[model samples]
Target: MLLNLYGIYGNFPLGKNDMIDNATQFGAAVASARKALGLTQRELALAINSGERFIVDLEAGKPTAQLGKALAAAKVVGLRLTATGTPQA
Candidate 1:
């Protein structure tokens, strides 16, 4: 059984409740999840209707990466996201 840095097991379910403090960290997590799923950057990009460069830039932690596309990539790789914060009224 392979154990990843995020405590993922053989099935490579990816991170759980991982805190992403910045775009770079989120990109890293997305890359990890993509690799765990045995998906190439191009494959992930195609799946999300994006160009390979998008995946490359995203995985490289480009802060300007579009949120919608990035989120789509993350979702395709099974990276579940849960936003938590105090709601501003």
Candidate 2:
């Protein structure tokens, strides 16, 4: 159900200027990808060196979740974001 919100395999192909728009959208992507990769929230937290609670909050779309850790979790699950028109670093 959640995966379908993004894609069958939870892979979203964004256009050059596409944006996630909000924390909930970003969280959904993260959750979908994590599941698609056969990971539980606690497992993902361990993999990202974060607390299980943090993963729960993140997947629940908690807007106050720390950005750096959130990005790290996303990275561990192979989710990426793009800022349109920004130069790659």
Q: List the candidate 1 regions with Cα displacement exceeding 4 Å.
A: 1-10, 87-89
Query: What's the TM-score of every candidate structure?
Result: 0.80, 0.74
Residue pair clashes in candidate 1: none
Which one is best on TM-score? Answer: 1
Candidate lDDT scores, in order, read 0.78, 0.74
lDDT of 1 by residue, 1-89 (tens): 11123423335644556677677877888888888888999999999999999999999899999999998987787776666665556
TM-score for candidate 1: 0.80
- Top candidate on lDDT is 1
Q: Where does candidate 1 have its weakest 10-residue lDDT segment?
A: 1-10
Over 19-85, each residue of candidate 2 has an lDDT whose tens digit, in order, gives: 5767787787788788878899999999988899999999889999999999888888777665544
Native-referenced Cα lDDT, model 2: 0.74
TM-score of 2: 0.74
Backbone atom clashes (below 3 Å) for every candidate: 0, 0
Alpha-carbon deviation at 21 in model 1, angstroms: 1.6
